[model samples]
Target: MSVSQTSGTDAVDLAIIRELSRNARISLAELGRRVSLSRPAVAERVRRLEDSGVIKGYGVHLDLDRLGLGLRAHVSLRPRLRSARKPQVLRDRLLAMGHVLSCVHVTGENCYELTIAVRDAQHLEQVIEQLSEMGDTTTGVVLSEPVHPRDVDIAAWLLCED
Candidate 1:
């Protein structure tokens, strides 16, 4: 596999990105007006951004509680043996599970960390049991989440000169 290199982004491109990040569904005319560009100019730039893989895609943020998934837990797995085969198999099994939202190969004492959401304690327990069957797992149920931002300040990081 080859990685494609992207051309350097200018101030105007950054401004356009900031505007789009604020509201992805904003009309091209409105966005161009905010960024002091014409609609066609903005459209062409957005098309380039998408083609160059700068703008991957757009997404919607949904509330887990509203979707009847109240219980959230973090499961840390420690493999019995440090073999490549068992770890890969365990990861594939976790990926197949519906309750496992995110699985991260992490550093430290644990091999993998999984973010899971379920309807209730019984459901969470079932997930835990399934995970335990694959390997030794330690689960921490989330009591509360203080901050979970959907969008981050990518413009600031991108603008900073290295």
Candidate 2:
């Protein structure tokens, strides 16, 4: 399964992306073996993928409980009527704050959705306190994650036109 990063990406490039998405730490030799290419060939494709920005950076997903970040919450921010804060300004402020795992600009009544990981209720409250200053926030603590984020679908990607 190859997920091309760009329009002109070929099968080998997509295959390389797919394998790496499954296991980023997989050895070049192992990846080559799986994709039926030599180590050097696989390495070249990986390098090309990186250069084209298909693969951004390799990362490890940590267990929040183990990391002492046991509390998880989504804070939805709705723009207030007389507030002069622009979205970019709010974004910059959000970026500066700690405990914000992911922040995305969205549509509808809410302007942004923020994923927060904190140590406990008090810590989460502190984050909410800050969020409230930015805008009116509706915070929801995550109870259980039924489905975690995963790799992209390479086959579906291949079927699409740029």
Candidate 3:
């Protein structure tokens, strides 16, 4: 189920998610072993999680450099009133571009923040040009990712029985 402010997600569901996030490739048997459930039981749980929209599809983490996309950048964009490019229009445009990894509508000065992967500086410039059509953009190259994706904060979301 959706872990909204109202809907209460079970701790077991949280644990299952934590393990799955760590390794989505984990076999049902192994996952069951770790979570102290039978294979079928765990399978049922995972199925529910998926059906409930808690578990999305599994995907591989790609090494972009090996894939020929060496440059990674975050392009902050704010829509210009002079153009037909509003936030929704910009989102559609960004989604259509192959290099755009993620385009999230955010709070504050910028309307959108885009995570982009490209071949090089030249490629980044071309992408920036596309973004500029939609809005004013400030590009920042991601030099390092000190802390990346990890498990969700358990205490923050998971309400206790006590």
Q: Quote the positional error of residue 45 for candidate 2 in Å.
A: 0.8
Across 56-76, the per-residue lDDT of candidate 3 in tens digits comes to 798988899999999999999
What pairs collide in candidate 1? none
Q: In lDDT terms, how accurate is model 3?
A: 0.80
Cα lDDT for residue 106, model 1?
Answer: 84
Residue 19 Cα positional deviation in candidate 1, in Å, after optimal superposition: 3.5
For model 3 the local lDDT of residue 35 reads 85
TM-score of each: 0.80, 0.83, 0.83
lDDT of 2 by residue, 52-137 (tens): 77789999877879999998999898856344257667666777887888888888888888899999999988888878876799
TM-score of 1: 0.80
Each model's lDDT: 0.80, 0.80, 0.80
11-101 in candidate 1: lDDT tens per residue?
6788788877877899999989988889999999999989988899987766899999999999998776555227577667777878888
Off by over 4 Å in 1: 1-7, 81-91
